[model samples]
Target chain A: MKYYVCLMVVFLFSVQIQAQKVAVFDSYSDLEKAVLSDENTTYVVNFWATWCLPCVKELPYFEQLNSANKNLKVVLISLDFKNQYETKLLPFLKENNIKSEVVLLTDKDYNTWLSVVDKDWSGSIPATLVISKRKKKFVEKMFSDYEELNQYVNSIIN
Target chain B: MKKISVLLLFVAFIVTAAFTSIAPTPYKIGDVATDFKLKSVDGKMYSMSYYKKAKGFIVVFTCNHCPFAKKYEDRINDLAKNYKSQGYILLAINPNDPEVEPDDSYELMQQRAKEKGFVFPYLLDEGQKIYPQYGATKTPHVFLLDKNRVVKYIGAIDDNVDSAAEVKVKYLENAIAALENGKNPSPEMTKAIGCSIKSKK
Candidate 1:
């Protein structure tokens, strides 16, 4: 009976995670600590927003990368306006069915923190950072398609 | 044989162009900015030399469409109006390609300048030649240049983009003040967060 109950709890917990709303992050350090906690794990972190059309276009490619590679985790860090979280970001996420671990960063002081992420980064949306135990890559541009993103992510993961 | 090699080179160019999307290394502090005779909203060509008596310029890369640019519009106007009297004139340039962003067309630029009561010349980086020289990465980017065209500062208008009232560090203004006092602006170059200057894909 205990074994059955434990299985039920595990299933329920996963279901909740599967339908998880975006995790809100009030600061950049909190985000970095949470996302980069596991050094052995590879992460494909993308900075994007709903208002940015190019970001929206390339989002599905990241989603495709997520479902295709279970070991490689993809985190979508949203920079949407805090006020429009309910009106725009949440609905857009639900409509598109974005399944990756998504987080919203409301940190206002960008210039000071951007260099910490990547010296070359200009804080533009659709920027990507791929990290693994052996290597890392930061690109301040969008991936044109799934093949482009998939190949780039795989190159880092391997 | 020559034709075959030419065909191979063309194919290689196409593949690389589609696959790679990296920002060019923009101007660093102390780099001398190039002068251009871009067309202004007034339908006349103007260059840095036009402001003969000024000590320096606040060249701002902005547009009508970007939300971030909209937020800084009035603040930018204030900067231009206030700083011009202090010997630093502001030059607003819309560097985005009109084909990629319809709202950034020349006609719309004129309309925006009128609507916002732009005190400075709002110019177009025709054929997108000038912005690349400065290595501007996004709309609402600023480059504070001395009378000799040396870049003194580069980046955002302030610390807070959402509300000008809440801004703590006025990056551009401080840079202007630094220049007036013959001192280097601390934190000379900073990162910009806005719409990447649109170009033909």
Candidate 2:
């Protein structure tokens, strides 16, 4: 009876850990609406991909920021090719147990919307956009650690 | 008190200098490109002057490892194959520091070229000087130049990176067409999306 109870407990814990639901958006307008829907919360939108090493390395920092802060909304937008949704991205999230809100941005019209994200952006991965109703900060580089990521969150929130 | 003030001033100067040492400006459209002598994977040293009869050059800053660069490798070869006979030589330069990315080392570059059957020159930016001069921020960044070495266009090969078939706009090809017709290329610059070029710490 005790062994059965232990197995059930382990199964429940695994289920909780593997719970990552990803939303897909085909256009920038839909993404913009979702991000701007909340005026009180600052959305920390991170552009990344499964193939980018720096992006994968910094995923935990975003996950920590997501759980610790209440007013900050964290969105991990995957730039992985649309075809890889089933084969690569889903398996990566499941295997790594990424809990943060994930989304697949299927927009192919990059030149039209890259400037909309930031005037200084050169369309590089591991870029970040911290946005609220009153202010916005765009960083076109990787956040080295949790401290640096926390600093960005604090700067935008306060 | 006077010594303390001097010390504070020295500290302020050091901080200011540290923050203000910005990188130099990169070449823009219409700017004359500086010729570089880089060693090719085929074991030949080449400069812009080597292509004596060429009408223009397709200068691409790409490497072997980046998945995005790998995606465009075949297309790059196609460009070289189609244009080499037309006097536009393709010169691919790998700028990633080998110390930072071992996979982008000179040997691998040679191996990739051999596997891909590349007829163009795949060169290594030895001291990592050429990319900064061109202001390339990522792999697969392209700079199209005319015969006089004036930059005609600087950006991506096309709008769609995921699939070659789904592409609606061919930016580089259009720019090359403009140059062929003796006109300034429309939309000379576009954002290139790819992996950041790894630099040594």
Q: Pick the candidate with the highest DockQ.
A: 2
Which CAPRI quality tier does the interface of model 2 achieve? medium
Q: Which residue pairs collide in model 2, if any?
A: none
lDDT of 1: 0.87
**What TM-scores does chain A show, candidate by candidate in order?**
0.86, 0.85
As for candidate 1, its clashing pairs are none
What tens-digit string does per-residue lDDT give for candidate 2 at A1-158? 99999889867765775674577888777988875467777789999999888899999999889878878888888988888998999999998777667889888888877788887788778899988875778988888899999997787778
> For residues A74-142, could you state the per-residue lDDT of candidate 1 as single tens digits?
999998988888899988987887778889988888986788778888766678988888466899997
lDDT of 2 at A36: 49
lDDT of all predictions, in order shown?
Answer: 0.87, 0.88
Instruction: Supply candidate 2's per-residue lDDT for B105.
Output: 96
TM-score of the A chain in candidate 1?
Answer: 0.86
